[model samples]
Target: MLGEMHDVLHEFPDLKDKINELHDNDAEFAKLMDTHDQLDDKIRGLEEHEQPVSDFHMEDLKKQRALLKDQIYDILRGLS
Candidate 1:
């Protein structure tokens, strides 16, 4: 979990420091944490499936990813 989280933070360096700071530190973290956790789990599940998925399914995942990213951004903005 920590390794994957590190890779995610490294991939998006802008959020790297902020995420480190939020590693169980903030009181307002619960709501944002839920969205983050759910998205991460869904992404992992989709990626780990043995069979290949259709383009349509890929598109759906992308949309969900975008929504999750937006939610994360909104939470960060609110904190700021």
Candidate 2:
């Protein structure tokens, strides 16, 4: 999944640039970044669990996913 994420950014360097461009001042981007960090931490925490039932982590992931979708939509809108 991380590889896929990297591929998306690599495949669309312009979009990545757009994101980086907005990182400094955009509240959405800041929130997205924070969500991404939380998702990463939660995922890492769950990784070592033998039988993890991570409903709360799943919710965090869902929120991050929605934020990502919004960010992508905003980027596409910018392109248009």
Candidate 3:
């Protein structure tokens, strides 16, 4: 869906509390979250036609988002 929120909590509902805790205390985790958010926004913009980008560029963006999501999941797993 276009314009859907893609925040960390939304991506990992089960780790809501841990995500909040890390966001408050872990600098690296916070930075990763920010990067993930920016990537998500850019991808959404392209998807919704708000930003013009080549198909290749859009695919690259999606790949980056997937990598970030995996990294985030790893962090969350480590926190468990």
Candidate 4:
């Protein structure tokens, strides 16, 4: 789990083109991506020891990351 990749592009490789399209043209989508990226970086930093975080806090961060991923997936699905 520590080394797992959660970047939207990697998580949804099949939707790469659509993801890029929306990220470029949709302000909301772009914002979501920015938030997701920030969360991901935070999680990674915690896991990799770049940042210190309690286990409970890390779990909460993982949950938030998953929720954002689901929201992004829903948008991608709607585009299909």
Q: What does candidate 3's lDDT look like per residue over 1-80, in tens digits?
A: 77677867789998989988988999988888889989998777777776777889878877987888888889889942
How big is the RMSD of model 4? Answer: 1.9
For candidate 1, which ten residues in a row score worst on lDDT? 1-10
How much does each candidate deviate from the true structure in C-alpha RMSD? 5.1, 4.5, 2.0, 1.9
Backbone clash count, each prediction separately: 0, 0, 0, 0
When 2 and 4 are scored with lDDT, the better candidate is 4
The C-alpha TM-scores of every prediction are 0.52, 0.48, 0.85, 0.89
Write candidate 1's Cα lDDT for 2-77 as tens digits. Answer: 1143123443578767766765687555455556566666656666653477879856865775665665666656
Q: Taking the tens digit of each residue's C-alpha lDDT, what string does model 4 give over 1-80?
A: 78577889888898899999999999999988879988998788777875767789888988998988888888888942
CA lDDT of 11 in candidate 4?
Answer: 88
The TM-score obtained by model 4 is 0.89
- Candidate 3 regions with alpha-carbon error over 4 angstroms: none
How many backbone collisions does model 1 have? 0
Go through the candidates in order and give each one's C-alpha lDDT.
0.58, 0.56, 0.83, 0.85
1 or 3: which has the higher TM-score? 3
- Stretches of candidate 4 above 4 Å error? none
Residue 66 Cα positional deviation in candidate 2, in Å, after optimal superposition? 4.0
- Give residue 68's error in model 1 in angstroms: 0.4
